[model samples]
Target: MKPFPVATALTIAGSDSGGGAGIQADLRTFSFHRVHGTSAVTAITAQNTRGVTRVDLLPPESVTAQVDAVASDMRVDAVKVGMLAQRPLIEAVADQLARVSLGPIVVDPVMVSRAGSQLIDNEAVEALRSRMLPLAAILTPNRHEAKLLAGMDIQTLEDMREAARRIHALGSRVVLVKGGGMPGALRGTDVWFDGTRMETLSVAPVDTPNTHGTGCTLSAAIAARLALGAPPLEAVRLAKEYVTSALRYPLAVGHGNGPIGHFFPLIHD
Candidate 1:
């Protein structure tokens, strides 16, 4: 018999040797959603659970070549972009992605830290906001990132809504301002805005210290659902649900923060 049909998704991100985040987490999340995963790694990080020791970025040409190799051979049903840490890499990936035909592109804006620190340079931030966000089907930015992008402080739920609106104006088809870093009872409440429809996506916060890869995992799950032909809103909803459940089954590995249970269904604990 012929091989079974399968949906394929591509992750254009960095590698986490720790296996908690970056390309490793993305592929795991894809597999959990039953989507075949492909990758074009932008950086290699020498790190484990505790922290990153070093990072080496792949040449922009090499990154684009990997993308070309995949696109020429197979149909990429969806694309998840994460952690393009500089201007050149950000522009290159955006150019390469535009040249290829892919499904919903989930842009995980990883430019700001939870502590309100700017993780990327101003030029890189501008490049991502200009090149990547415009191509994004869904742009996922956490509290601090939304603060940077929208040029406003996010201290309340309404602030999140405003941030989402501002980001949506920047051309992303949809903007999801993640509230995981928000204060008080609003922590797990996510604000979604798509120019027209706006709503808050909320779930009871999962109480787990092993929340490593949460951002990457959630975006990857969204891309996985997109690969499987789910509508944008439905994909985000499903991904959120998946992340919440996986957090409940957190893995107790690593010396520091560990990964959430990607294959939660298989764990018999």
Candidate 2:
């Protein structure tokens, strides 16, 4: 008998040729969750596990066309958006997603790379907040991005809570302030703040240097769980577990940073 059609997830993001982050990581995370994955490339990055050397933003029309094509044919249950390079592109993606009525959107506010290179421009950050956050089901911003969005320094757990509240007020129904960037912490803590309540999800940081794709993997896994009919909190829980495992079995590639083992279980398979 033919297998049943898996729930589909669409990733609107950049292409990371390194196979560690961006569209590559998104697709791998979806596959690991047993979901069908589709993509609309918004930008192309000359990047590896080491760093992003260059970025080329795809034309806004081309980006819109890809999203339209995928939405027209596929039953996209969830979307993970990342690495929109410019203001016009951000606005275009927001517009296209609105037109298609894409549900269960997980916005990973990817601003900088693991190697400390700025990914999104200054103006695009504002555009992202105004154009995209309102439509997102959940906004996943790392501590630094959270600070940028909340317009203040988040130096403590209390600050994280306040930042989450402020970011939620910006229009996202849920805000996940990722705490991996916080100082004096080996255990990564993610604070999930829905309108009604706040929950802290903590995991001991995997002792590995190969963490090139953690954010993209986490956000995409959440999208996959959402596609599989999991609630927001539950989705985040599962995604965190997956990311921790991935980090534990990171691929020992590249001279600088290295990619996480997305198919870490494939050795058994």
Candidate 3:
């Protein structure tokens, strides 16, 4: 068989040894969307479907070199950025992104893991806000991350909206505040706040314990869509739908929370 043509994407994020989230999830999501995915690993995580045990951040120069090598050679159409562990690393990414001028950047503000591990430190949040958000075409943050960024509790749908607004004001072009953690809701609800408008998207929540990489999957799927020239709203819409289906058919792989079935279509079809 002839090799598939390269439809490239760049993921600047951490590596998950368990292959469920972080760089692993991002690459799988991109490939599922028919794009060739490249990566610049920001950190190495000792984790599984259960949770993250430890994380060692890559040095700033190493991170920068990986990005530069890919950007210089590949026809990268979109970029997805995940966990940057410290201030210098965040700034380094920001600086390299500026140099490369990659657009339709998807920034996932990964704070705590699904297993309740702290991915980003308190000091790094400000750097992410000040240095990275402005470069993103869209910022994807779960409810807790939105609350931390907005410096307020998001207990209601109204508060979610308010949080999105504040996040938009913090230099992101658009904010998609994921409401998975919101109270009184087991449903998959997320709100997208563009500068002048707000939209709510919801799906019937799947009953499963395999949601470890949903956030990373969503952002990478969006980047893949954008690489194929989809608009922002459409990109998000398709990505959400894709994630919903993936979650509906999760891989029960580990002792604790497992991975979503990234190849669900192949299994089902």
Candidate 4:
């Protein structure tokens, strides 16, 4: 028999001690999609289901070291970036990504927490917009993040479309503005734009308090699908489907928002 082909993905992000978001969630999502997962942790958060108590960023050199090590050895097929929580970290990540020829980069601009709190400073936001956005193959930002990136409030579907356009103009090949944070009927509806075309993607909203890692999971799934050789748009669609299915069964592990069920298929075995 011929040797099996390998699909590898890299996640450059923070470490979530809660095991619900950041690097933990990204790796889990990659594994579920059958992609080899590697990560470069940029920060470490002392957090749990309830909330984040503290956060410590790694030195810029350390972050770059991890990325260099992975890219030097592995044929990484895709990349997912999350939680570059500081300006220095963002700049470091942007610089290293520029040097390495990793495949499609999926950037999840994680600027705000699920509870509506700003996580990154204004300088960091600007750094990401100017330095990292241009390198992204797909930029996935939730309603709040889109608001910050696009410099406009996103209250309606039309607004999301506008936001996607503005963000895409920043140089990302495509933009996916998640409407999960929107109130009522608009929830779960994601606006997708590829500079020329715009569309909406949605699945039945799964009702659960466990949405801690939803953003990380979705972006990582997109990277995973891309690593598996799907085109950008198809990768986004498959990633959405995967997240929706995973959300169907929430793992009741913590008191606050828990993680999405990233390994449902394996759990049965």
Listed per candidate, the RMSD to the true structure in angstroms reads: 0.9, 1.6, 1.7, 1.5
lDDT of model number 2? 0.88
Best-matching candidate per TM-score: 1
List where candidate 3 sits over 4 angstroms from the true fold: 1-5, 114-118
Arranged by TM-score with the best first, the candidates are 1, 4, 2, 3
Q: Could you tell me the lDDT of residue 8 within candidate 4?
A: 95
Per-residue error for 55 in candidate 4, Å, reads 0.8
Q: Candidate 4: misplaced stretches above 4 Å?
A: 1-4
In candidate 2, stretches whose alpha carbon ends up further than 4 angstroms from where it belongs are 1-3, 114-117
87-164, model 3: which lDDT tens digit per residue? 999999999898886657999988765434566778898899899999989999987788888989877788888999
Candidate 1 shows a clash count of 0
Q: Who wins the lDDT comparison?
A: 1
Residue lDDT tens for model 4, 136-239: 99999999999988999888999999999999999999999998898788899999999988989987788888887899999999999999999888999999
Clashing pairs in 1: none
Model 2 / residue 239 / CA error / Å: 0.2
Q: What is the lDDT of residue 241 in candidate 4?
A: 91
Model 2: ten consecutive residues of lowest lDDT: 111-120
In Å, residue 113's CA in model 3 sits off its true spot by 3.6
